[model samples]
Target: MTKLTLYNNLKTVRAQQKLSQSKLAEKVGVSRQTISNIETGEFVPTARLALLLCLALNKKFEELFYF
Candidate 1:
């Protein structure tokens, strides 16, 4: 099985959008630590949450995470 790694372009995307972790968390309905964890590749988000993140970041899902 392919190990699922949490690969995130969150920091870059957030910077591009001029959004802080708190702001992004609020937009995505998650805690700031969740964004931190994702950005640090420490926590993999579920499909539902990934969709939420992609929407909040205004990015395609593939642009956010991949194998």
Candidate 2:
């Protein structure tokens, strides 16, 4: 089995939108620590969370996450 690495430009996008980690997390219904983990590649968000992030950030799925 292959171990896949997921990649995201979340920090850049979040900064571009002038949102703090806590703010984005709140909008996406997650905790700030979770957002920090996600940004650092320590956590991978579920499908629902991904969609929520897109809705909140006005980004496409591909534009945010990929593996």
For 37-66, candidate 2 gives per-residue lDDT tens digits of 989999998989889999999999999998
Candidate 2: deviation at residue 21, Å?
Answer: 0.4
TM-score of each: 0.89, 0.93
Residue 37 local lDDT, model 2:
93
In candidate 2, what residue range of length 10 has the lowest lDDT sum?
Answer: 45-54
Clashes of each: 0, 0
**Tens-digit lDDT string for candidate 1 (1-67):** 8775557787898989999999999998999999899889888888999999898887999897877
Supply the TM-score for candidate 1. 0.89
Off by over 4 Å in 1: none
Residue 36 lDDT, candidate 1, scale 0-100: 95
Residue 26 in candidate 1, Cα distance off native in Å: 0.4
Error of 1 at 61 (Å): 0.5
**lDDT of candidate 2 at residue 66, scale 0 to 100:** 84
